[model samples]
Target chain A: MRVVLPAGTTETALIDGISAAGASPELMAHTPSADAEILEYGEPTTAPLTPVSPSGCPTPAAITRAVREVVGFDVTVVDAGLTEPTGAATVDLDIDPGTDVRTPTAVPDADAIYDRAHGFGASLPEDDLLIGETVPGGTTTALGVLTALGEPATVSSSLPENPVERKRRVVDEGLAASDLEAGDCDGAPMEAVRAVGDPVQPTVAGITAGALESGAEVTLAGGTQMVAVAALLRHAGVDAALSIATTSFVADAAGDLETTCERLDCELTVTDPGFDRRDHTAMERYCAGEAKEGVAMGGTLSLVPDGKMAALRDRVETVCSRLGIDADGSPKEETGSNTTE
Target chain B: MRVVLPAGTTETALIDGISAAGASPELMAHTPSADAEILEYGEPTTAPLTPVSPSGCPTPAAITRAVREVVGFDVTVVDAGLTEPTGAATVDLDIDPGTDVRTPTAVPDADAIYDRAHGFGASLPEDDLLIGETVPGGTTTALGVLTALGEPATVSSSLPENPVERKRRVVDEGLAASDLEAGDCDGAPMEAVRAVGDPVQPTVAGITAGALESGAEVTLAGGTQMVAVAALLRHAGVDAALSIATTSFVADAAGDLETTCERLDCELTVTDPGFDRRDHTAMERYCAGEAKEGVAMGGTLSLVPDGKMAALRDRVETVCSRLGIDADGSPKEETGSNTTE
Candidate 1:
């Protein structure tokens, strides 16, 4: 199994309460780089940041790393778009970060990035391909893409209590700026991505198409964002069998993942890591519905055996301690409240 | 077999009669890009240029392409250092092109490029990894690296006459500019690459090291340039077994491939494709030693069966005809003398 994470960023993440993918919106750009480094080296050696929720929950990279420590699978990070350079070695696809979704040009090079990623995907060995994504404010773009493709999308947020009105308003502004209405780009999948989708959408969708061509079983390793990719694939007329894997946090969130998967004729696998039964602060925050799912948290969690959850939690705890985060999902070195409260 | 071509460029290729890897000094920078495109698409679409000898002999990319058309192996181009962009999708390692070897910092980011490529190599499946290179004037850099690593060095040239004195002069000037003697960087391999070697060296060496770490059998797919990579690996205290593959043209060149491989404890395979017996201008140019070995021409040629030479020659003839190169490797559309004469 190969975990391919295409990392990017967007200004939409800067909107307060829209995303909790990083310690703050400014730090979100560094999350993908940190995740890549931690997955490869067990810690971030180059970037001074780590992917964390606003409530201090460790990002899914720690979970994936813990699973890798035991399962010994390979991880490859693709730089779909990055505002900053990553210290970790990545397959640089020569893409730039997405602009604000409210702007006319979100991912200006969406088609080109997709074609390039298609070529990259063809080069991989035909194995089980798990494609995850890391783009701050990705769920908002997911909504933008889905609505443009005529799919009514209800996306999950990293913050609890889902900021429904704010997300709808943001997507509405983005649609107006792009001069697109709901279902305007239903038959033109890449156009939706070009107008309002994040770079990770075309990248993950292209890789999936190419990997399918190479006879690899592909699984989108996120929640609502992956549903958007599936929608793109469906609209593009790709008839390959596809699957989506996500955490139960997302399955339980106020999202349209199941119905959308059904409409696209895609499989859905919801893995529950038993976070509610766990005693760690990050786990508690996850249970509280803050930082539900991002990265490949859901797909990677499926790799852990039921008996191995203890080992995985221990690794997660160790990583949190290293980050100076405590059991209540609060920073030990800095004073902050658990935002989920 | 997976062919990983690390494309790069150097001003050393601009030296007269030193490299026939392109139609002219200006076109040399595009040779790797063209080779990558043609290898992926069976023809060049993005760059108008094609890899060709000054004498109009088709570069090794044609042979590799023909073999790939028949065998259907995967081709991946890596942007080790490119002066120009390629139309084909590439695994961008974010490296820049090398300056002239006479400069002190020909490959300033050698160590970092190597480390990044190492990470990439670990991500690949453990199989027989064929690492080829497309760097014009690479043989000169090979000599610089070999001498710096204290290996008794004789490197081949794409030009028929070998331009021995010019290559030696260039290396001497480079050594002086870097304030180093012939054996000054023996124990410190990457230092030599940084000071005088081209970017492809560190990229290939790093990938080889990383692939070896992942339990893959590796073959350096070129003549003198890949030998330089082997030298780098040995000097860095890599104890893994390795092999080198090249065409009989390089084996018969005025070089010390056999002696060097013996000293380095690496296996060498010399493949002869019967270019002398083929009835074609490009094949004749190859037989006359205008373009000896490059772009893994030797390694890919080894994949053809003994009886498939006719089909291979036909494919070569088709490619040459498409390029408007005639029986004598001169332009079919214009008058020019064969440089080998």
Candidate 2:
């Protein structure tokens, strides 16, 4: 019943969900990278910067080492290298040569990333495992993936004070620039990930693969971003029993969730039941029309045994508290941490 | 659009939601009850109080009189009455007549109250009418209704400082006493409401009736409680297109919402896109299944029209500011108001 928590920026939320479930969680941060910068902007701006190494993706070395160090268990990190560099634009648009006049590039490497992420080998232990993600602009990427797949998607930051319009604009622009056609792409799940997916997709795919390989139960953490990752896993021909742990807000936006679950080949579990009671001012502004991607987080986490749950949660909280991130999981906490800690 | 807002204790939330939508609204208070105590509790107590007269159900006379006093127009208040005085308990338990129970009179005349409050006539200026409700312990009733209906209903107060487990217990106890048997009722859309329906049911039923009579679109302004009311209206043979405005949280918990809508025969709208992003510590703690109800209010107001949205939000904010309801929607505001305002 030992749960291994991969350290990511969203530890605050992930940990809270786990700890509240009364599970024992061990927090291990993936090596910090200059590549990923949790950004806080008063206004949306278009600026070109160095593609920081997608350190946001849990490094295989870190994952393996952490598993051995913290959980004292044998674990393997599947290396799914999608982007040439970690810190690429939130979205990568490529023009396929044989496609129409305006075609977007389906990064073959991105497909490889998904494949490798979802392709865990047979050398893994069989136990209940919770898989989570750490990706930058994940919601934006999720929006890109959903839009590329011809589903309306909205990207909202978990930051309390973030402007809804700005987040929506970023997602819309990314999806538009990707040359995604309006028609439904039933197979667009993988394409969406390949076109604009991040490291977390492969990591989650790997976790799914590992679950399949080890015959273990798995839970994907974070919000819509993780759901998109699960979607990518299903599309990659990996059929496994998987669930998501996310806030209630995502569930509301993603109507007809049973259909979505059927399509994704997974169960939907909404965490933070109280989320349904509080006011989400940004719901209409950003998430209303789109199907929610990540609401299954809590229910998924609940599947984890109590001991592991506590460990994962405790570690997450400790790190987040130490980092001075708002334990509530908003990006606002991260803003202060960027320059300070 | 010009919106008329009836002033009540919790009117602030409704007003803010309206004003935020950039609509002009007129606010008027119900004539204060000569002996109205403005009931205040340091902590939510399980003690049942006499049900207040559904006389608060805007009377036709009162509506017309108020319209004349404020807008100088003729208006009607649908009379939805309570069958009996408030039940001795907060929740209505319906066990087998001979079942051994400690709480002898737990099952209140919930259905009778609903029935009594069932005859508010249609709005005269149908297109101009938007109906809303203000019910104390609504989240508890919402939970009861959902649980009775065989849905996994979870309630959480929006009180930041309150303990999650305590809130959940209150809701759970209230729901259990309601004694909702398995399987849907004869004409009920969902079993939850029938098992423990409240005054709001018949009130909104009449509101829907009134709205249809006048050919005006109606908006049910509350969270899960209103949703349940909408459900009850459909069950009572009301045929009208209705829209629901609520916080994203409620929508999230009520998974399979499309089924709920299909059963209820209405459309659902969500306010607060940022609902998921906000750090709802107390709410989430309750969501861990520690508590069944949370003190949530902000999202309830957004159920109104755009014109009324902001005003309702501002009103809530103003009241909270004055009363200091804490970061979460706790009763701190009430305490401050009692002492000062």
Candidate 3:
């Protein structure tokens, strides 16, 4: 399965406690390649920890690298809208770019984005794609779309604990600023996402749905944010051979992801990489629920068996060690293993 | 044959008589799809004539359309660097992107571009590929690359009449600005292209070379600019059973293309899409030495039969007529044929 990470940024990420997708938005905007940032590329050495989820345990960048190492699948990062270039050989899909969801027209070209992205996804010329994403504060837009679609849904967070009220307030604020009313998106998903969702939701949704129309099965490979995409598919009255895969963290989180998938009409699969046994204290964060899920950490992990979890853990450790990042995701004494070093 | 159009702009194209690729530099910056401005994408329909080549005759855009209509193949446009988006599904490859070639460090990441582009080309997953490009001032960069490689070559221009003296001045100025001296690129084609060429040269060179390395039959499908790519492959000691396919205009042009190919060690295939018999006055201009070549018009036209030239002519006329463009490519009365209209 191809790992597709549709990424973006919203000011919602800046609101304290809203997201842990990255150490900070600034860091998220520039992770080089997962392997590059961790192993090669960049320096005078900035961000010793690279970018990690709020939970010190598992970083999306680490897990993404594990997917590349363990599952050995093709990986593609789509810049739906980003603060800066992610130093990777990315497919540029900023046709509509992206914007702050706090405004009424968060994605003014929602329709065009859908069209072009549909073309983009449909044109992938690949088979059995596993589409994932990592946009900071993406869940805020997810909740906004879910609320507007009248889905009675709550999404998981990168925070160890889900921030229901804060997320709700952000959604509420976004809704207040938006022209959408409850159930307005019942038949208008693009408009719903346009008004309040981040750029990646509709883009991934379109790609998934469009590729499905082209008769390819796709895994909406992220957390509850994927619920927004499924909701878009469900509302658009299009049926896709789609399944939802995420981390066991989200599977075990407080969000109503399973029921959300049922109504949205998609399968839900979860994989826990069993980070608890790792020597690093940060690996135990999943057990504590600090960084539940982000990236396609869960879905990508699902491609491998429970047996490969050890390999995944080792991959992360190797990358972190090489980058001088401790298991807890902080700078440590220079390892001198890095090329520039 | 997949049409690949790698595009960028050089300030060299800004000098009067330097390039007629577009009507004016401003108009040149946004040529909807092909190398010429088009009537299809923009609204309130600007540039009634859409920017054509210096000649009042046929456009490479028309030839590309001819290829699409007659040959029917997948087309991919790579944005090596451009002033603005081309209003098409394009691939973006600007690590530093690219600036005017007049600067010493025009393409800062030449090696990376080559590597990434080679990866891109090698990863095509397709068996056969045809890559074309449409940088307005690509030929000037081509000339620079050729000169730097110690090849006494003169490339054809989009302008009906080759801007030899003007292009020579730009190439000399660019060479002077570039740190590379003549023959310095014998084993460093990318460095030469980087120092004196546009983003497209090394990029397509890398793509073509990488695709060939994958044991796939590839066609370097443009005119003189493609020579720069062939040079890159030759100098790199990389061997590929690569062939060149272009239009009669470039084939019959006064340039030493034939001798260049002989010394460069590549088979040259030229197709003469009989533009002389076409009733379209604009197309007849090809007979008059205007708009000689551009886009992948010639190479794409090569994919079909010589007899299809009439059909290709008809396709352009139909597209132009539907877009409210007259046979000469100027705007006629609004046809209400425009989707936006």
The best candidate by lDDT is: 1
Which lDDT tens digits does candidate 3 get at residues A135-218? 667778888888888888677766654677987887777777886577777788888888888787877887787778777789
For each candidate in turn, the interface RMSD (Å) is 8.3, 26.3, 10.9
Report the candidate with higher TM-score, 1 versus 3: 1
DockQ of each: 0.06, 0.01, 0.04
* Candidate 1 ranges beyond 4 A from true positions: A21-24, A305-310, A318-341, B1-94, B100-139, B145-166, B169-196, B200-341
Question: Which residue pairs show backbone clashes in model 1?
Answer: A281-A327, B281-B327
lDDT of 2 by residue, A1-341 (tens): 22222212222212222111121222112121112111101011111121111111111122122122234321112212222121111111121111111124323345554444443322223356655443333455565566566554544343323334544454344445565553244465656655544444544565467556666677665566665666666655667677766545455544555466666777766643221222332122122222122212233334444456445344333333322333343433222111100
Ranked by lDDT from best down, the candidates are: 1, 3, 2
TM-score of 2: 0.31
Candidate lDDT (C-alpha), each: 0.79, 0.36, 0.65
Error of 3 at A303 (Å): 29
- Ordered list by DockQ, greatest first: 1, 3, 2
Worst 10 residues of 1 chain A by lDDT: A332-341
